[model samples]
Target: MLLCLDIGNTNIKAGIFEGEELIAHWRFSTQRHRLADEYAALFLNLFALNGIRLRDIRGCAVACVVPPLRVVFEEMIQRYLGVNPLIVGPGIKTGIRLAVENPREVGADRVANAVATFRRYGGPAIAIAFGTATVFDVISREGEYLGGAIAPGIIVAAEALVTAAAQLYQVELIRPPRAIGRNTIQAMQSGLILGFASMVEGMIQRLQAELEEPARVIATGGLADTIAQEVRSIQVVDPHLTLHGLRFLYELNRRR
Candidate 1:
């Protein structure tokens, strides 16, 4: 079994794969202050609940956006799993040509998404990850990682509005009964959810124009399904895209 970790700014998503099949997965809040032993304990408890033993995990792959947690997880994997994790960063064999200005500036999560998207769906394809910051990564028909766009995530935008405005408080991020909201909560939801849907559609159109052809739109992340239902442009939603990408990357660079 391979342990795949997708550590983002908001959450840490872990998956245990038996070969290519993901047997079990879990999500936890990202805590930067947590020690290696604490993480090890948490993983051990999860493994026990899932009927997976620590010794069964043969390899580990990590796609971490949180810099502080990288060393924490690396240490935990080395100390507890007894295997050095394949961290997604420089020197990793991603099997995609990065056409961006500075490839190093690209987030590891984005790379993972691109790798998985292109491999699974092929290109031209656009992968939108609605995480801490909503990111759109474009892959060409020839498997080139053409950089896309980034915008403030729906939750982030809603939180910012609540923080800046004195009267407005946070509301549930759901689509209102109608676009013309009846009340304050409805208005906020309309703006946050429906408005985001419109933004996604428009961005997809713009990106497709730049690509000079129509591309398959893939959405992932916690809010992906919610927003994807509202937008017609998003064709696929696979929440575990990053985990699969980690597995793919691990296979690409595994010691022979």
Candidate 2:
């Protein structure tokens, strides 16, 4: 079995794959202060609950954005699982050609998403990941990793609105019954959810215009399904895109 981890700013997503089949997966809040032993114990409990043992995992791959947590997981995997995880960064064999200014500046999670997108859906394609920050990664028809845009995540935007405004408080992120909001809560929801849906559609239009080619827009990350349901441009929502990408990358660079 292969254990794949995608450590993002907001959450840590993990998957256990038996061959190419993802047998189990879980998500947990990201705590930078957590120690290696603590993480190991938590992972052990999760694995036990899923009827998996540490010894069953032959290899591990990670795509981590949090530097501190990345080191913690690396240490935990080495000590507990007895496997040195394949970190997705410089020197990893990602089969896509990065057409960005500095390839190293690209986040590992974004790279994973690109790899999975091009491999699974082919290019021209766009992947919108709604995580700590909503990121749009574009792939050319030739399978090149063309850089895209980034915007404030839905939660981040909502928090900022609440923080800045004196009267407005945080509200649940659900679509309002109508675009013309009836109350304060509905107004906030409409502005956050429906506004973001429009933003996504507009961005897709702009990207397609710039690319001069039609591309399939795929959404991922925690709130993908939520936003995707409102956006017409988003064709597919694969929450496990990053996980599958890590597995694909691991396969590409697995020790022979």
Candidate 3:
């Protein structure tokens, strides 16, 4: 089995794949200061619960946005699993043409999403990742990685609003009963939820217009489900897009 880990700003996602089939997956809060042993122990317990042994893990790969956790994961895999996991970074073989001004600045998760999107949907696609920051990554018709926009994510933006305003409090991320709200809390929720969905649809519309062809829109991330539920433009929501991307890159480079 191949172990795939995706460390985002908010969460650490781990998946155990038996060949190409993902057999077990788990999510944990991202604790940057956690010790390597702690991380290893956590994985060990998870594996035990799933009837997996450490010896069964033959290979591993990771796609991480949190830089501090990189070494942590490297050590965990090396010490516990006895295999060096492929860490996605500058030298990784993604096979996707990146058109960013400074390609190195792009996050590994973003790159992985691009690779997976192209692999699944072919070319001229846009993947909107609803994570710490909502990101829109564009893939050209020729499979080039054209960079897209980044905005504060729905939850982050909502939290900021709640923090800045003295009276407003945090509300559920669900959409308001109607676009026009009857009460204060409902109105605030409606504005943030439906308003954000509208913003996503509007951006996708503009992106499709500017691209070489009508791009297929896909959403991936923790908040993807909430926004995608209301938005009609998002065609697919593959939460494991980045993990699959890492697996693809691992196969590409491991053979070489």
Candidate 4:
């Protein structure tokens, strides 16, 4: 089985793949302070619950944005699975041309998401990833990773609002009946959820206007489905896009 891990800023996602089919997957908080043994124990418990064995893992791949956790996970994988993980970064064959000023500056998770999205739905395309930061990765008609914009994610923005305003409390990020809310909590929720959706739609529209060709907008990340549910502009939402990209990247690099 192929073991893939996507360590984002807020969450760590792990997937066990039996060939091309994902057999089991789990998500946990991204504990940057966790030790290698602690991470191993967490993985062991997850595997045990699903009737999977550490010895059954054939290979591993990782897409991590948290630099501190990279070595920790790598050490854990090596000790537990007896295989060094293929880390996604510069020099990785993602099958996409990065047009950014410094391609290395791009997050591995974002790169993986863009590569997978473009491959699945060829460019010109725009990928709105709802993560720690809501990222907009754009691909040109020629299939180049033309960097896009970034904004505070829904959760981050909400947290900021709550922290900055003493009167405001953290509310569930959900869409209300109307754009104008009736109460303070509803208003905050509406502003964060619908407002974020509007921000995405506006950015995408502006992006489309700037491009001569039309771009297909796709959404991914943990909060994708929830946000996309309310936003009409988002065309597709693939929660496991990063893992699929990691799998694709693994295959690409394995042959090389």
TM-score of 3: 0.97
Count of clashes in candidate 3: 0
Model 2 C-alpha lDDT per residue in residues 1-256, reported as the tens digit of each score = 9999999888999999999999999999999999999999999999999999878999999999999888899999999999989999998889999999999999999999999999999999999999889999999999999999999999999999999999999999988999999999999999999999999999999999999989999999888999999998899999999999999999999854
- Residue 4 accuracy (lDDT) in model 3: 90
What residue runs in model 3 are displaced by over 4 Å at the alpha carbon? none
Error of 2 at 206 (Å): 0.6
Model 3 local distance difference test score: 0.89
lDDT of 3 by residue, 82-142 (tens): 9988988898788888898999999888998999999888889999999889999999988
Residue 42 Cα positional deviation in candidate 2, in Å, after optimal superposition: 0.5
> At residue 166, what lDDT does model 2 achieve?
100
Compared with the true structure, all predictions reach lDDT values of 0.94, 0.95, 0.89, 0.88
Off by over 4 Å in 4: none
RMSD of each: 0.8, 0.8, 1.0, 1.1
Q: In candidate 2, where is summed lDDT lowest over 10 consecutive residues?
A: 247-256
Which regions in candidate 1 have their CA more than 4 angstroms from the true location?
none
Candidate 4 global TM-score:
0.97
